[model samples]
Structures are given as structure tokens and as C-alpha cells.
Target: MGRSLDILLFIVCLAIITPTLNANKLESSEYWKEQRPEFDSYWQEKAEIAKQDNHAAYFPDPYAVSGNFTASISEIITLKSSRRNLKGGKGEKCLATNPVDRCWRCDPNWAKNRQKLADCVQGFGRNTRGGKGGPIYVVTDPSDNELLDPKPGTLRHAVTRNGPLWIIFARSMLITLQQELIMTSNKTIDGRGVDVYIANGAGFTIQFVKNIIIHGIKIYNIQVRQGGMIIDSESHFGLRTRSDGDGISIFGSNNIWIDHVSMRNCTDGLIDAIMGSTAITISNSHFTDHNEVMLFGASDSYPEDKIMQITLAFNHFGKRLVQRMPRARFGFIHCVNNDYTHWEMYAIGGSMNPTIISEGNRFIGPENKFIGKDQINAKQITKREYADAKHWSSWQWRSINDEFLNGAFFVNSGPELKNRPFSRKDMIKAKPGSYVGRLTRYSGILVCRVGQPC
Candidate 1:
């Protein structure tokens, strides 16, 4: 009896100490090298590429407004009301309020002209030609029952093909991927007019590739996959380790756009872009019922992530979200025109001298003011040691034209940085936060029939 009691005590003690020990282990570079070797190698490769390309030239001021931009709250409201009444309103052209949405959603024949979405993206990742100028491939099968040899016409087969291709679904599907959907370069997964879903299984992994667009999909109930031999392309079948279970994992890639996606209830993060991924935009998406919603940079120690530039625009950070929308590190993040309805913890957070430009976002704090301490939680170097303070104090985290409701406030930090001056040649201003609801009304995947507006 005494031995059994002792064993129980030992078990309890082990449970208490194991997490702390694991936490310490995770902080070591060696731990990551062994556990996530792919991430480590990818980071190293990106660092080498950054050096060779002198990629510092690509880092633009995230805070700089695009083109000659100007908009008033009343004007945005008027535009939003007009857009809300777009359905069955004859002689009234489709007038999307946001620039990104306006780019593609305006076409009444959007279902037939699906590829037009590749042209509509704005901000940092505007140049992404996702399967543009490529042949269209349709996914006719929905089953993911076979991981080793995915049948032709399956979603798995469509994504694994080499080279540029525009992929569209033949019908609405609920795909539970057997393994991580390893995507190749120059692919566009367009789910317009379809109620396509990825749930109860693995999610997407965009790694070491470029020029991809994932639009109008619902990703939920994602669980980790114990990885194995997975076909990445037609010519390649490689062994993969376990996945982190993100709705979308963007790793060591560039020129990517993820728009109009609705994500929730993932085992890990809803969306995670890590390991020096850059030139990306995540817009017109809705997030709910998740913890650690988004994570941009992988580590604070990896300074090479300074090249990471992402634009988060026109997204709705919706109900029951805890934090990290997103938690950035060592990157240039432009968070604009997002509507934050609820956050248990702070909305945005970062360390490691990341430059975050929050503009025209509406932050509606939770009813419990104590939970929402600060809308923007930035690190202050003054409280740290002299060496750490000097380094962190130089970070440029600024807020402009942001609306804080219900006792919410932004905790600004770092150097006094000015918005880069611009000429009015072709400016575009983000709509006010008051219009966020209307702008992001159709933020998720649409269910449109053929020959109908999507």
C-alpha cells in the first residue's frame, strides 16, 4: 500500500516538473534541431537566401499607406450599406467596400471568372501570381481515404502536382486529410461557389514554396497528424514528421495570400507563418473559438526574421478568441482595417523588436475590462536590463487611426517612427473600423451555384 501511494506521489511530482522541464528544453536550439529539424533547416536556408539576394531591399515600410489614400467614416458607411444591398439590386454594379474585396468580388460572373481572384490582392502580397497563366485543374473527388496513393481527381492529387496550376473543386466537399496537404509553388486553391471544408483531420502546410493563394475555405476541428511518407509532388514522395495542426501553416515561403477563410477550433494555432516566411497577406478572414489565433515569426532569437513582411487586413477577429491575432517576432507587420469583437487576453502581442503598424482597426474590448488589459501589448525596453532595453527600445510599434471601444487602449512602444511620406500618384486608404463589419460580412467561404454571383 505504501509503495502504491509513493508511486502516485511520484506521478504527481513528475506531471508538475515535466512541463517546466519541457519548456526549458524548447528554449534550447538543440531541442528544436531534433524535434523540428525541417524548421531549423528551412530557417538556415532562408538566411542564406537573404544574404545572397540582399533581401533587405525588399523590406518596405509596413505603415506606409498604399497609393493616394483617403476615406472618411461616413463615406465608408455609405459604401458598406450599398454593398450590403448588392443582391438582386438591378442596375447597381457590385461595389465592394474594401480594396482587396473589390478586386474580385465585384464581378457578378465571379464563378465563371474564378481566376480573376489572383489579380485582386493588394498590399504586400499583391504581386502573387497564384497559378495565373497556368492551366486549370479541377478536383472531382473528395475522399482522402488513401494517403500513400491518392487517386486522380482527388484534392490530394490536385495539390501534389508539379508546376503552376489553378485548382477548383467540382462540388462541395468535407475533406479530412490523412496527412498534411503539402503544397507546391504557384498553386491556387479556389473554393468559390463551393462549401469546401477541411476538418477533423490534418491541415495545409505551405513550406519552401512561393506564389500561392488559398481562398474561400472553412478550416476547423483540425488535429495533429503523425506524419509519414507523403507525396509532395508528382515526382516526389518524402517522409514527413508530425504536424503542428494549424489550419494553415506557412513556413519558409513567400508571395502568398490567404483570403476569405473561416478558421476555428484547431489543436494548435489557426494560422501560423514561421521560419522567415515573407511577402504574405492574410485578409478578409474570420477567426473564432481559438487560442493562439496566429503566430508570425517562429523564434525571438532568430533575427533573420527581420525580412518577414505581412499584411493582415479586413479580417474579423471574432468571438471567444484568447490572444495572438497575431503574436509577431522580428518582422514588419501591417495590421489594418480588422475588426476585433472579442479577446480574453490582449489582442496583439510581440517581442524581439518587431515593427507593427496598426492602422484603422476597430478593437471592441471584452466586457471584462480586466481581461483585456491592452489592445496592443508591446514590450517596453525600459523595464529590462540595459543591454536588452537598448535593443528592444528601438522597435517601431505604432498605432494610427485605430478605434478603441469599451475602455480598450493601445500600449505603444519603441522609437518614435513616422509614416513614410508618399506621393498621391495611386494611393489607397483602408476604410474606417466602423465599416469593418460590412467589409467582412462575407469573410468566409461562399456557397454560390454555377452561373450565379459568388
Candidate 2:
């Protein structure tokens, strides 16, 4: 009888200790400890450089761009219903649709305060003050069609200028780029009050740069450009390699905010951020008809990508998109309040233990059975591969408050713990999945008149 009592006591102790062990597992991992120091050091160096150059430091105060939502939730819903009935009405007021839009779009004098957009970004890249300290450079010549020596007053010339600059177009223009438009650091290409389209030609390459904002433009129908001698800056001309023709290729850069742009039909990924890039927010944009929409990390084996933290907020993934809304590896991604109207195969797949927190998004699967069935196959393949490697359980992929329509489902895998790997306080609450349509209704390029609200 005494031996039986001792066994019961041991069982009680075991039950109490097991919870403690599980809770401390992530904190005590040697891999995480070793990586923590390197991550801190790299960001510290980048922060110092940003301070020295008087550039916007990455990940500034979250409340810096907070918006006052004047419209109530019921009012927003009624507006959405009214707008849906009208179909193509352009006069609808798009003031308080989302936090990003409400921050700057309500004012009638948006043209006069165009530079105020630099202060209205949220998420990890909130400090991306693109060309705020620089002079405004107006582009008068839309004639870079030859891809030869870019003349003065051209878009190419404005991008290749020496210092920080806010580049604005003189009029509505369709620029058929001759080669990939390589950008420098600290620039804002403001396309408000103009119909600017970069199509039927090359795309953009943002390599080894920082603090850039590309807003209010439409980029589509991009083809591969055989590389040649191109002018990067006024004083520096170099031979560039063949370009892959991504809508916006962000490589080894940081502090970028790409907002209110529309993209489709690129040769490669719509937006590819790789090679240790961090502090990026791709918000208030629209993407459609693209395969491999966004790729966050370069390779699965490159562990340095653990520093890559990007926030994809208030965007719209529209029709005919296949996989990789963003396929991340060894990074953290916050995909919040996006409207995913259609996807062909599957949405949001990754490898090498990336942390993906998908919150309050509306994912409407394809209507046809063929497409929905293909998503199941893709999901199973990813799960089986990761499970076989025995790395699936540790990766933190969570779906919270998401609306899955048309039998769509998110296959989440991770430790089922109350606490997340990252801090939840840093993120703002995303609009509910039901409200995504109203939030992202005005996703694409806006035609802003000088005297009217945009």
C-alpha cells in the first residue's frame, strides 16, 4: 500500500514538471541563443548608419502614423455595399477605408501635402521616410524609350541623381523601360495626380539601397531585358546583367514602403525581397495574375535570413494568382487584413521554419473543383515534406481570425502555445476578415485630382 502511494506522488510531480519543460524549450534552445547576438549586432550597425546619415531609423514608434477612424464600422459596411452596386463609380469618397488610407487620403489638399505620406506608414518599416529631406525633382521628359543615355528631366535621370530626391512626373505617361530601372538609396517616386504606368517593358531593381517608397503607380506586362551598359547614377555607369523582370526586385535593402501600387504579369515574382533584407512594409497595394507572387528569403539554407521581418498589410491578392503569396524561409512575416479574392493552387507556403502570422484576412478559394483540389495536393506535399524532415512542429505558422470562403482552409503547423515566438504587442489589430473587402476596395492605382480628395 505504501509503494502504491509513492507511485501516485511521483505521477503528480511528473505532471507538474512537464508543463515547465515545454514552456522553456524554445527559450533554452542553443540555436536561438547563438543567433540572437548576431541579429542584434547587425541591426545595431544598420541603426547607427541610419542615424549618422540623418535617414529614418527602421521600425520607429508605431503610433507615429496612427489614424483616427472617423467612419464607424457600420458606416464602412454600408459604403462598401453602395460602392459594389455602383461598380465603376469614381466619385466615391475613399477616406477611412483602412488605417493606412485614413492616415493621409482624407484631406482635400493631398497634393500640397504629398510629402506627408513619408510619415504615414505602419509596421516594421514605419520609419521609412523616403526622400523627405531631399529636394523635389520633377520629370518632364518621358522619352527613355531608347534605353540609351538617359537624358535630363527623364524618369531615369531623376532616379540616378546623386542625393536623396522626391521624383514626380509632369504629366500622365506610359514609360516603356528599355532596361531594368536600377534605383539608388533614399528616393520616392510619387505618381499621385498622374496616370503613370510602367508596362510592356522592363521593371525595377532595388539592390543594396535603403529608404525608398514607390507609390500610386501601375506596373504590369513586364518582359525580360537583356542587360547592357546602363547609367545607375549621374557619375557612375556600369554594365548590368540580364534582368529577371520582377515588378519590384528588392535585394539586400531595408526601410522600404511600397504602397498604393498595382502589379500584374511579371516575368518572375511580383516582389522578391531577399539577402538579409529587413524593415519592409508592402501595404495598400494590389497584385494579380502572377505566379510566385512574393518571395521573402533567397534560400532555405541561408540562415542569415532570420533577420528578414516584413509586414504585408492592407493589400489585395486578386484573381489568377498561383502559389507563394510569399514563400518565406527563416524569417518572420505578418500578413494582416489582406483580401485574397482568388488563388489558383494554394496560398502562403514556406520552408526552413519561417514564422508566418496570418491575421484577419479573407481567403476566397477558386470556384472550380480543379483549383480547390490542387490546393489540397499542394498543401499535403508541403506538409509531408516538412514533416518528413521533422521540422514542421517547431515552425510558427498560425492563422487567427481569418475567413476561409469556398471551402478554403489554412493548414497551420507549430507549437500550440499561448505565447508566440515574437512579441504580439508590436502589431496592431488587423480589420476582421469579413471587413476585408471594404478595407481593400480601393487597392489599385488611384486617379487623384489636384483639388479633390484622393
Best by TM-score, which number? 1
**Runs of candidate 2 exceeding 4 Å displacement:** 1-94, 145-148, 368-389, 421-428
Alpha-carbon deviation at 19 in model 1, angstroms? 17
Please give, for residues 75-102, the per-residue lDDT of candidate 2 as tens digits.
3445543332321125656455765676
User: How good is model 2 by TM-score?
Assistant: 0.78
What is residue 227's positional error in candidate 2, in angstroms?
A: 0.7
TM-score, model 1 to reference = 0.81
My TM-score estimates for the predictions, one after another, are: 0.81, 0.78
